[model samples]
Target: MDLGLRGKVALITGGSKGIGLATAISLSHEGAKLAICARNLEQLEEAAAKITDLTKGEVIFVQADVSSEEDCKRAVEQTFERFGRLDILVNNAGTSAAKPFEQVGTEAWRQDLELKLFGAIHCSSYAIPFMRQAGGGSIVNITTSSAKTPPASSLPTSVSRAAGLALTNAMSKDLAADQIRVNTVCIGLIRSDQIEKSWQRLAPELTWDEFAKDPRHDIPLGRIGNTEEAANVITFLSSEAASYVTGTSINIDGGKGAAL
Candidate 1:
């Protein structure tokens, strides 16, 4: 199934590892030129090498923290400077800053919002003009399932992600005239770098396989999702295959989410 992404330029945030890295590889498989940004230069370099090795695709890595507006601008500018045009922007940079409702202080809330909400806002703002110049484009924002189905102890992330979903819908409407498509991929418990860290910290005695086994039973599919699974869906939304789709929040959670 050709996704019509050949020669298109894509910029993915938090592309150092996990879902972002997987998405970059997926898009590259569709023949898209890739630009990825992350806070850690070392990780970004490693990820770029891996993606290039797998797809033999052109990939550039930029070290930029998306929470900062200036960094967001720099990421977009760098991508455009190298690729000459930007067709897809994937807002996949964020962390799970979940805390109990009582523990979520004002500063915590502000920081999470800056990283998740404002990060997407800043990236899209910079990418829009270039996309318009290119005649059309796509923006895929990575959010969490908690945005739609609020669960206990899911703090700032839930609130910020819900805002992201709103932004996705609103931007889709506004950009539809420009031939730009906006969509969000709401995630569930996907096995990724972050989850690996949590598992190690929460249960140092258990091996990854053992730790994952417990939660696998909880998911309806009898297993957890992988980064590639989420990435496959994201690249679809970022390509012409989803030409008629916009303002939609699709869940990649293996039936873990309670809401529709």
Candidate 2:
């Protein structure tokens, strides 16, 4: 079914790889003009090329670290300047910080919160104007399932993601009058590039398949998720089909989270 997203403009943060890259490709498949940003120019170029190959759609890559307020502003501005208007903003730029509470230093806590929470805040602040200019739009913030059911050693990420969830709910109510819908997608163990790196460093003996199947948690599905799965949900949330979906934090974790 058509998502009615043709010609719409979307800006995705941390779009050079992993879930962000997957979302960019998914949006492009729906015929949306894309502006993807990341800190590394080389990776951005590679992702842009892959997106073009997949969707044959218009895609631009900008070098920007979402943790910096200035970079966030510039990224949004450049997107509007290139596309003329923004219809969707996917705040997916973040990392997984899962150190023990006692082990997490003050600097680590500050860095994680700065990158995950403030990144979305800064991007949404700048993108709202363009969305309003376009008459209305959607914002999908990529959080984690830990926000709802945080486990031991889930510090920094869980705390920051909880704040992100609150942000989503609050903005959904506040921005309703402007026709700007805000929502979040909570993730589980997905097969991202970052996960691949972790496997290489921590379990080099195991192959990708073996690594994903290693019973780390009692995931009901008995396996990890994929980038495309998460991206599909995000793309749906950003589309007209999800017009009524706001302030809700949906888990794409295959029933791994205990929260109802």
Candidate 3:
């Protein structure tokens, strides 16, 4: 289907790997110009190369840690400077920081909030003007299902993601007048770098497929989700295909999340 993404510019944070990289590639394939940012320059370069090689589309990489307000501003500025306009902003920069409530210290909570909550805020704030100038745009915030149905021992991550949900809802209402649509994807156990690290650390002896189907993850679909699966919904929300979708949260959890 024609998603009406051609010639549009998209900026994806944490785009160096995993779901963020997958989303960039998907958007590029739909003919969207991409500006992807991450803290690691090497990963950013590699991801840019991969996207360009696959889609032969315009892809720029920016090295910036989204947790910092200054870095978030710079990332948006560079995207606008490179593409002249920003059509989509995917706030995907974050890591899992789940643990027992008591185990999460003040610094840990602060860092998690900074990266997941403030990161989205800073980027969206900076990107709004550009989106307004372009007439309209989309902001797809990447969150987790834990925000809605946090399990035992889920601390900082759950709290931080809950704030993200609130942010998405509030931003959608505030930006709808400007034609800027805001939404979020509540992800589950998706295959990504972080998951890969967990596999290596927890059960390096088992094959990936074996580890993923270990039955402990409890995904109703009986397996973990792939990065592309998560990316597809994100691309749709960021495109004209979902032009009317806003202030909503979609769970890409393979039926793992208990709450709607």
Indicate the TM-score of model 3. Answer: 0.97
Q: What is the lDDT for 63 in model 1? A: 96
lDDT for residue 142 in candidate 1, whole number 0-100: 96
Model 1, span 190-227: residue lDDT tens: 99877888788988798877776666347787666888
Please give the CA lDDT of all the candidate structures: 0.94, 0.94, 0.95
In angstroms, give how far residue 240 of model 2 lies from its true place. Answer: 0.5
Write model 2 residue lDDT over 1-260, tens digit each, in one string: 88989999999999999999999999999999999999999999999999999899999988999889999999999999998999999999998889789999999998998899999999999999999999999999999999998899999899999999999999999999999999999999899877889899989999888888878857888878899999999999999999888999889888898885
Question: What ranges in model 3 sit over 4 Å off?
Answer: none
Residue 81 shift from truth in candidate 2, angstroms: 0.4
**Which residue pairs clash in candidate 3?**
none
lDDT of 2: 0.94
| Candidate 1 residue runs with Cα over 4 Å from true position | 201-210, 215-217
The residue ranges of model 2 lying beyond 4 angstroms of the native Cα positions read: 201-203
